[model samples]
Target: MVIKEITYGGLSREHLFDRLKGYPIFLNEFAEMLLFSPHFCPSPQQQSLSVAEITVGGLGLQQGGTLEEIRKQARLLGLVECPLEAAFYSRFYFTDQEEVSKKVVNQNPPGALVIYSKPLLADRNFPRGLYLRKIKGDLWLRGYRCSDDYVWSPLDAFLFQVNASSRTLE
Candidate 1:
């Protein structure tokens, strides 16, 4: 099942942009930061930071759960074509191309739907990670103040690079 999730990139938007010094920042770089340092993804606090579980849906593939419901949700989001195993890992979501063309012209979040129909390599033991082909014309990009904090690891960085490069390749 396709699911909607929010990923952490280990550094805030502001910190990242400050480090970039105005250089174009890509998702891969975020992944690298996660993997580069072991402390990047610290274990969840023993006590509950909040009662809410981070898992959006019960489709916990990592914890031996099913993804049928998650995929159904993605379908509800209008993703007609998607990988069969996409639910086993992670997937990115964005608007379609035509929508992107119309809405992405501005610097705000692109209206296109971009799905990274694959999982992260670090989460599982597979190489080549997941593939995020531009299934639609929507660019699926976002801009924000450089002061956001998104933590990541080196492995995360590698995955980010792989994902970003794959898009560029296509």
Candidate 2:
């Protein structure tokens, strides 16, 4: 398979860290900046026209709703409740342990993250964007694409690397 390298539009690895100034930074407001700022030339370069994506946070929609839990509570009270009422509460469930719930935004202060990084996978489905989540007091970064539900990779993977002084192509 022939894959092309993807570059993040702004900042080097070290510089990105500098911008963060450390974890606990609030990044929920810059979703759009992280998405198109650098731009990715469609993973497969031939998937479809374009994919639609909603910026990560902002309304609490990202965290799903409390209807299911509330429904159960109402049902226990023997009160008549509409089944459809809880539909809006649908939460994002992950198929793998690696996936983080949108609830992270709610649980974390300032409510959301705006993180960016290099591409670890150039597969057609891999999205070229940023992700931020706070879990157990430690902040974690993720690279999640639109249309699909999965973190392409972790930001930590790029933390350490040596620069090559020259290319070996003939």
Candidate 3:
């Protein structure tokens, strides 16, 4: 389900501009996640945290689990589509587009959905990470960050170069 909130660069109004009661600062990022994976759900923690679980990939990455755990699971599962960068995107939820990936232009032709860990750079109106892409006839992306990092890895920086189309939006 798409989040019913106005957003720019993935940040919704409730997160960047309006501070609603009983909602965590990262809620907006989690809301956008629903747009990517149909099997995922957001579990808010007392308006302080937005945690999720990965159930569709046959992976046991659970809610409240640290970002490293998700990375480890992806590695163990050897999901080719779930690249090492999925972890980086999840860990650094709010890095700039330039910080998203070095090459940036990923599978934009097919349209990709980037998911994020947490809302990093919440103060800068930045976007979160771990957008989704389909390969092997399935959607895959991973990460769960509690804090945002500005440091962009090679694949992550390329996220900026991606030209997302409406295809992935489905």
Candidate 4:
């Protein structure tokens, strides 16, 4: 699979949101809480990253498991968690929402692209993760909170950071 390289940083949170004006984004309550929380700090310096989009099945968890299991599988497969800023950058750079929506409409599947990063605690200390999905022609930047026992689906797509030197899985 081809890896996508993107540069992130050098912009304030408000500026980043302003840049996403033309693009559609829907933030859920959890997402809003997380974004406004003190924990959602973006990097100050610019950094280039190589990222990969893969499915839970691609991580060798056909039946899926909890987040901990998912992370372990990703590490074993030579994938690393993305930084928190990656969620913002990925949503900003992923301009092909219409195409993704088309595919979801035709395929009739839940097409959400989740950015795998260190889970941040939102209100009430809920662990939140960011995901992007286009529904009814509207793009959504949603946040989800799942328990430790929650089992992810095999078809669930995840975006992860790829080490530049280690492209091939172990």
Candidate 5:
């Protein structure tokens, strides 16, 4: 597992966007909607967070599972969901192309790294999750809409909060 200490919530939405404008980022329509929504509010003070990147397979779901199932497994493994702002800051700070390439190369079936957070409702009240991907040398920060029964792929990577009690996995 790759763990990173991320500090977020000090900047406004526009400032964040301006900072990200220089990067190779592509936000889908749903992502934009979610970002600008009233539900998406950053913290008033800067907060430090520890985030871990793991795959569905790593979570012991060889066949993949629904969002609820995945969350259960994560809980069993001592992992907790991240905040919505973690996704934005994660994409903003994860600029090391080589590191991302290595992760992609290690995946049996490469896929986006979806941040495990409280799902935000998008258009039509669809639950949305933030995901990061490196495609054709360009970084993507997109929002994916999934229903309660939607099953995530085993190869899909998830970003979760690393709490103090979380067990360390090799």
Candidate 6:
């Protein structure tokens, strides 16, 4: 599906990161929009748009109230919670045990992950962009997105899952 381009406009990197630190979905949506819609701007009348997203972290997939944990973490670091205006709901997935800790050793990190890597355009920087809960069953990445927001192929998802698993092994 066609998406819209992200208009960072006057937003600075620090501002973006600061906004994203507490709300990972903002970054996820931003990336998705940038990738899909390099130049997408709907008419002002197009108010309802579906957005799909995938967030992988300690928690596995998307779950409700996950943002509170993210917000808490950001609060600890003196950040603010992201507003609903920044994003919308889509889909969520929780990683299985095999994905959390791998038996094989690789260049990936060790933990649950949901990552995707593309060319210089979009790449999943696992373990780095990822944040560990430091505890189990606490939900890794606390975010969600709508289905229309993402238009991923099976190969894309598989490759990302594989890479994410590698990170857990590390």
lDDT of 6 at 98: 33
Q: What digit string (tens of lDDT, one per residue) describes model 1 on residues 1-170?
A: 22333332444434543443333323333334333334333222221110111121221223221233333333443333222122111223222223323333212222212222333333322321222222243221221211112221111101111222122223
After superposition of all CA atoms, the RMSD between model 6 and the true structure is 16.8
Whole-model lDDT, model 1: 0.26
Q: Relative to the true structure, how large is the alpha-carbon lDDT of every model?
A: 0.26, 0.28, 0.31, 0.74, 0.76, 0.28
Q: Name the candidate, 1 or 4, with the larger lDDT value.
A: 4
Best by lDDT: 5
In candidate 4, where is summed lDDT lowest over 10 consecutive residues?
99-108
Candidate 2 lDDT tens digits, 1-170: 01112232234434443444453333333332332334422231211111111122211234332323322322333222211101101101111113344453222223223222244345545444444445554444434443324321212211111112212111
* Root-mean-square deviation per candidate: 16.6, 20.5, 17.5, 4.0, 4.3, 16.8
Best by TM-score: 5
lDDT of 3 by residue, 1-170 (tens): 12111122233333422332222222235334433333332222212122232232223533323334434443454321222223323323432212123233322213333442334333333333445433333333432232322322312212221112213222
Of the two candidates 3 and 5, the one with more favorable lDDT, higher being better, is 5
| lDDT head-to-head 1 vs 2, winner | 2
Q: Candidate 6: lDDT of 145? A: 31
Off by over 4 Å in 6: 1-12, 23-105, 121-170
User: TM-scores of all models?
Assistant: 0.21, 0.24, 0.22, 0.83, 0.84, 0.23
Candidate 3, position 144, lDDT: 27
Candidate 1's C-alpha runs over 4 A off are 1-27, 42-89, 92-108, 112-145, 148-170
The pairs that clash in candidate 2 are none
Q: Please, what are the lDDT tens digits per residue for candidate 4 over residues 1-170?
A: 43688888877777767665556576677667666677788677888898888888888999977778989988876788888777877887665754354352222136788888887753435646788777777777777766667778887888899865674642
